[model samples]
Target: MHVLPQVDSSPSLPRTKRVFFALNDYERRVFFPEYLAAELDALNGEAHWRTDELPSPAYWQTMMQELQPDVIVSCWSTPAVPFSLANAGSPLAYVCHLVGSVRNLVPRTFLERGGLLTNWGDIAGKTVAEHALLLALAALRNQPGWRPIINGPKAVPWRSGTMRLQPRSLYGRRVGIHGFGHVARALIRLLQPFDVEISAYSAGVPTGLMRSAGVTPFTSLLELATRSEVFFDCEALTPQSTASINATVLAALPDDAVFVNVGRGPVVDEPALVREAASGRIQVALDVVCKEPIDPASPLASLPGVILSPHIGGPTFDHFPHCGQRALENLARYLRGESPEALITPELYDRST
Candidate 1:
């Protein structure tokens, strides 16, 4: 039999209270693969809340009042874990959000009451960084331009005597990343083998670390845009950052430069991006859009040199179990009275997407 190192064959997790499944079946299947779920089931306590849709907020309050579970495991579709549900019986001791960003689902009261909140910040960073890398490569190679050929009939020959879009290589290109968070750092490491010049712009990253990583730290967005062959915007969306990438910043890039956005849509000025790409001054690829599903009337849907995906820039179904295992590890640590990793503090939330 094959041995999987990640599965714990040791004693079941010692727990005093119930652990609620604050996610749907699809999410559970992804995060808690069969083996891992079985391992968890073997733990000291039973898993609760297996509903496809979580109970109504009022009913949730009543459920909490009754069961007072010690732990709540959450994911993308989870509703906010209300303060009333937390207690000595349940205490709302910890929440393990398998996905990132608790800004919407996690209520402020939970944080105030000192409940342990954690997200996929422990593992999702690398996966998201890889998505950004995929966009970078697709943009560099002009994947959008050639995509129409695939949509066209196979009646035409793929080989052409004259190529319409000259494929560009990633080797030795100057790459600029707007935010030096986990995704940017992971991207920088991935680009190392390609021998690309890396520079980053983010107030959050220390100058010393950038220098140590062989990444040039550009203090201003304009400078990073002006100097790179390819640029990545991974900035978080905050009121202060909302229109940070305006027309002037986009125009600062050298002509024909590739720009990728795997970050928040609002961080880039939507109208300005549409105008820029329409003018053919710069190339752009996006996994996130200003409006979801891309409005049929939006010019971005037809613009040349623009590639878009429906915001699936992170780990897909197959890799979800890895993220799940990471969450289970955190759950085990909390049951053992240790500080679960990736605890979200106010400062951390402010910096996250």
Candidate 2:
């Protein structure tokens, strides 16, 4: 494997640390260019821009060899190039667009080989967890469908009988979190003020951590579904987790239970979830879906008692600036001979990969 040459401070060009940006044309044209321009103005004439649409692995490899950039800023779930790029010397710092799951972004080999990975996980995790909590609250109060009616002009003369659903308090309700990852931890922290009991299920988590979080560790998915009033899917998508929430698990839940999925869509069986919602056995609030942009005719779209969002749980203006700054910070750290803060390791990969 090739390694990058040592930085030379006493050079002709000052070795201004060549960095490249890889993102789609639209993102480059709209969001990132201004972001890069503002945060990277200090680099001035040093930074280079390359806007490509899903460049092939060969194209990336060739570009790496030619430009020999000190670092690359990737804006997406996964970089287009193979792990060999890291092995071939140039380090890449990933600035994820949104959050929820990282399984699709980092390859197994890259994690095993110690690739530097940083994300807006701090911001995204907190934001999405709060969003999920809001959805749960909405469902509990039966405000999911009623809010739209009250907000419209017609609501000014609305009759009381039209919006008569008993609202329940969230206190004392059991909240089950599936997959004890970064987002789950954030959610647990956020729920501390609500005085709610918490439970979680994660194959990778240690008993000590679960105990520390004050969450009951459930050994089986059935237990998580059957016991909790609100079941939150915070797990990532992997072979082990794909379609993990099936009909059997859904059947175990209470008839009035609320199901919230802020995780990967594939982790839950969409059809089974649709059936549960359609049958009035469960209420669902989905921020992610198996098929993105959800097809118009999909059962999930028309399911009664389901609240759908376009997978925008983690996107906020606050998130972007922080993520961009963190990505740059990680790159700077790598350049300064220090390890990046959120470096992807074999252990993190082993869980999802």
Candidate 3:
């Protein structure tokens, strides 16, 4: 009789399952909340110190060679993994991300090698949607321009007989969204209570989809822009969409309209946006800019109609542990030989790449 190796399939997990946390202390503080950290501590793992500034490939390779971690957990602050780590000799089997977009950090080769990658997914979208709403309301009220006139050294001193257009409220306004996506959909759901007329333009997506989501669908982006009192750009940032919103698109927005962009900055022509907002015809609220940590001298910084937040629309504090919990759930499934939810498919890889 031939003897075969027995597979250990038990409800009790392997205590020796190795995990590598690829983030420094600062990253841990920012991304890995205390609740999640405690959960991670229960899993057998070694914490590796690494920052984006010094993404030493050698350090990663050395750690992998020494510890031979079975899984890795990382965030935006973590550096890209070395391609060589996808080799058959490599012990790496899976990666869990707290961040949303993985195209930059996750190499296509890793996916090709049958590696599993999971992320926060819908958790990220919902939180970003919340920030988008905050910005829209702030833009509608022209809150950015208020601070100066109220009290600072730049106070306007309450002029005599100089009148202007009153800021519009989100209620009863026509809201148009360009690129109906997860974030846009969330925005619509949140907007349901406000009783705003909603219209959306999604390229390639069927018009009926948006209609079913309780929003009117427009054929072209220009038509959506022309009809909207407030316009949102929630399009994915891809090669096909870089700077898709140009001066012409900005021109299409109605006079005294509010333009809010929590999406990627490259989609909009920064110069054109500055010019339009400078004219006082458009109130621009942006969470992302063409260039991040915008220069102090940048014209957009001085514009009263423009409000800017430092790309903080996602990965909120309360959300850190939520992503970790989702990742842990998927990790459990992966160990059980079941399909891990949120695994990046070839189709998803194509859309992002």
Q: Pick the candidate with the highest TM-score.
A: 1
Per-residue alpha-carbon lDDT of candidate 3 for residues 108-165, written as tens digits (9 for 90 to 100): 7788878888777778677788988998898877686565556544444454212332
The lDDT values for all models are 0.78, 0.70, 0.76
Quote the lDDT for 262 in model 1.
86
Kindly list the per-residue Cα lDDT of model 1 for residues 206-279, writing each as its tens digit: 88989998999998898889998899988878777787889989999999899899888988999999999988
| Model 3, residue 306: C-alpha shift (Å) | 0.7
TM-score between candidate 2 and the true structure: 0.82
How many backbone clashes are present in model 3?
A: 0
Which residue ranges in model 2 land beyond 4 Å of their true spot?
A: 1-17, 24-46, 51-61, 77-79, 82-107, 111-114, 147-163, 350-353
Candidate that beats the other on lDDT, 1 or 3, i.e. the better one: 1
Candidate achieving higher TM-score, 1 or 2 = 1
Instruction: Score residue 35 of candidate 2 by CA lDDT.
Output: 48
TM-scores for every candidate against the unseen true structure: 0.88, 0.82, 0.84
lDDT of 2 by residue, 60-117 (tens): 7787778765556666622554455555344444323222235555565554454555
**Poorest 10 consecutive residues by lDDT, candidate 1:** 1-10
The candidate that achieves the highest lDDT relative to the unseen native structure: 1
In model 1, which regions exceed 4 Å deviation? 1-15, 52-54, 86-90, 147-162
